[model samples]
Target: MTKILAVRDLHLAMRTGEKLVPVLRGINLNLPQGEVHGLVGESGAGKTMLGRVILDILPPNAVVTAGHVDCATTGSQIKSGGRIFSNRGRSGISLIPQDPMTSLNPVKKIGKQMVEILQLAHTGPPRALQERAEALLAEVRIKKPKEVLKQYPHHLSGGMRQRVLIAMAFSSEPGIIIADEPTTALDVSVQRRVLRLIRDLQKERNTTILFITHDLGVVAKLCDKVSLMHSGMILEQGLVSEVFHSPSHPYTRSLLNAIPRYDQPREKLAPVAEDLQSQLIDEARKYDQQRQV
Candidate 1:
């Protein structure tokens, strides 16, 4: 397990009127190659922002006041946006965005879009490229792969489009991929299929993945390591077994407690107590202020 990606003391903020509202506070992460690391947190905890920063696709208003990202495959430390600006690390980090419906072009045929993407990371005759595209679709377990190749994004179901996105993400054979809750919009069965496909392809490619989601079940099923985030900070992170089996942080324990277990069916899901949530935020603020010293 070689170190593939490392994020150190990362602090990111967004512009709000005349102020910079900090979103990621003193974040630190280390990802070994060929592993799936889960980033589990409630919305607005800076989970997606972390993924965006790593992929160099942060929003236009984003301000990276501090921190650096180190990728072993890209040949240098990424202190800022130089790698993405210079096209050095662009091809090495791919993203399977949350929305497959919008990730692909609505007007372009799937084959054309896929071909263009494949050409970014490969080159050959047009026919060969098309064949490779279809093969990728097949690899994701889409039936009638050739027909899918000729269709438009709107013509396919949400699940099919997601599978195509997964295929495209791996087509680049990138060293790391950020899957930003790719299953959010899908039904239960479709989500399972897509998760299985992603897990299988990840194993096949041996690519490190930053899997962002709030579902403990998904984390347990797909991730090797888990980082429980809250208020833009990692409250706890360790092996999935250790984190889920015995969560130490109050927030982490509350998150696990919120999950409904079939083994011990509950009348109602136990939301994190309001007082506990407030205490967690206070703790995060204290930690953030400490880092400023």
Candidate 2:
């Protein structure tokens, strides 16, 4: 399989005035063409930060202490030592960010925003842009896309906003897309629809994806492979089935034990044991200390 994106031995830190806090520690990730790779972890695990780094949207105070992110496209290649400094967002990888309501522009009309985004990677007349915009929306199962084009972001429901974002993400015909928990804010029923739409569109376009989420169920349903991130480290990664069935890392096993399965009813939600969490943290800190030596 052709490689689309690779994050190799990457390390990052944040500079908060006088203090530098370590974030990602030696991440090694690979996304082959046309596959959805899940980065599953709880909050503060730094998966979202990894996605942002890939997209070259890191905070100003962020420092890439080590590593490289390399992405390949048909016409160009982009490799950042720690960051990318250019206006190539639409031409390269795109992001379908979490929170559809907040991701879309509240002030801009839907059609106007769509037209602006389309014009970035496509050149066409007004009529052509409109047709393409509607078609894109329709591709995501958005009905009455023409009407949708005229409405404001706030006028649409959460699910519809996400669908529109998905449409925009594919408008650039990007090779890689970072879907950072795209369905996190939607209701469960709507989340199912959004997830189905994402899988369908990914298949149709053959786009590689980095699906970031804390939900193992979602990973099982949508991802081709899984990487378990915890405290800025990838504890274990492999085929989704393999990781779910036979997790090798202690942190990975703890995460699996934490999930509530319908088939295996539990008296209460069994959270990861405190001792295990502490041990993992201690190990990660030791690694960080060794790297600084």
Candidate 3:
């Protein structure tokens, strides 16, 4: 398979009070031309940081100690290292950030934001741009494209806003879409709809997606491959079926076990074993040193 995006020995860190807090430790990932890869981890396991790093949007004090997010754009590779350059108007890579409210301009209409994005992308004619935006909204299964276009960000529901973000991400027809917790704040019914919309849109566009979430159920439904991350390191990476059916890493097993099983009574999530936690922290340090972060 042709890789659309490749990350080799990635390391990221944040500076806090004269001390550098290491986050991602040598995260090696590959997203092929048309595949959905899921990055699953706990709240602070660096999933979001990895998403920012992949999109070249790390925080101000954060530095990519070492790594490259290389994307095959047009005929050549567009890359940024050390979280270096700004990627505001770049194409072929788009990030549907965790919250649409934060990503969207509250003062701007949805139509205006999408139009500007398409215009920046140098897409088609004005009519074509509007049509594309409408089609994108329809692609995400939004009922009324024209009505949604006029609505402000605050006027839409959370699920609708999420779909709007998805539509905007695809407005430029990016080769890769990185969705960071796409269904995080939605109700279960809306969450499932959004997930289905994403699955359908991915198939239709053949877009490579890096879906980051903490829920295994969502990963099972959407991902082709799964990379189980814990405390800043990938513990297991394999096909979704293989990883779910027979997880090799202890962390992977714990994650699966934590999932609510219908066969038995719902129980509290079992915390990761103490030894496993220690091992993970140790492995993280080892990865940092290996990558020289």
Candidate 4:
């Protein structure tokens, strides 16, 4: 399969005062066209940082030190040393943020927000934009699209707000989407429904998605390929089935063992071992030292 996005030996760091702190180290990843690739890691593992790098939304203090990010969809390449090359005017990327509550504008009506997004890729009269917004809401399976459009973000349930974001994400028909822990704020049942809706939309449009999350179960359910990240490094990556059943890295195995299984309800859940955590930290320190020299 052809790759929609690729990151090669990417290194990123943040400048704190006079010192530089590494965030992503020697990272390499590829997202094939029309596939769901999961980036799974615990907090502070640099998973979200990687996504931010791809989206070119890094913090002001962040800097790309080495390697490059290539997006075939946008015909653009972001290189180290602060060089960016683009072949098109608009980046063919969109984002579905983690928190739906804060992602949408509290002061703006749903219709206003949706039309604002549509206006970027479309130029038409108010009625045309309104019709397009209604169609997009219906596509996400939202009921009474017109009524929902006139309502505020606070008036809708969590699930409905998430659906509106999803609709906005696909409204531009973007070639790639960065879904940053989109289901983390939702309940279990709502999470499942939102996942289904995303998967269905992805298949219908053949869109490529980079799904970032910490949940192994969600990865198993939604991802075709998976990467396990820790301490700003990719510990292991492969087909979801292969990685789940036969994790190659010690960290990966430990993470899988930590998940509670319904079939083994009586079995005690195991946490990641302390010794292994110490070892990994030592390894990361050594890597940082080597890079510095």
Top candidate, metric TM-score: 4
Clashing pairs in 1: none
Q: Which residue pairs clash within candidate 3?
A: none
RMSD of candidates 1 onward, in order: 1.7, 1.8, 2.7, 1.5
lDDT of 1 by residue, 122-177 (tens): 87999999999999999999999999998989999999999999998888778989
- Candidates sorted by TM-score, descending order? 4, 2, 1, 3
User: What TM-score do all the candidates reach, one by one?
Assistant: 0.94, 0.95, 0.90, 0.96
lDDT of 1: 0.87
Candidate 3 vs candidate 4: the lDDT winner is: 4
Candidates' C-alpha lDDT: 0.87, 0.87, 0.82, 0.91
Weakest ten-residue segment in model 3 by summed lDDT: 74-83
lDDT per residue for candidate 3 within 1-293, as digits (tens), equals 78888888777779999987898777899888889999999888999988877676667888777666677743333233423333543577788877766778999999888888888777578888787788778878889999999889999988889999988888778888889998887889988988998888889889999999999999999999999888787889999999999999878898788787778766665766789878888877786567555
Tens-digit lDDT track of model 4 for 44-114: 99999998888888889999989899988777777777646452424388888899989999999999999
In lDDT terms, which candidate is top?
Answer: 4
Clashing pairs in 2: none
How would you order the candidates by lDDT, starting with the best? 4, 2, 1, 3
- The worst-scoring run of ten residues by lDDT in candidate 1 lies at 77-86
C-alpha-based local distance difference test score of model 2: 0.87
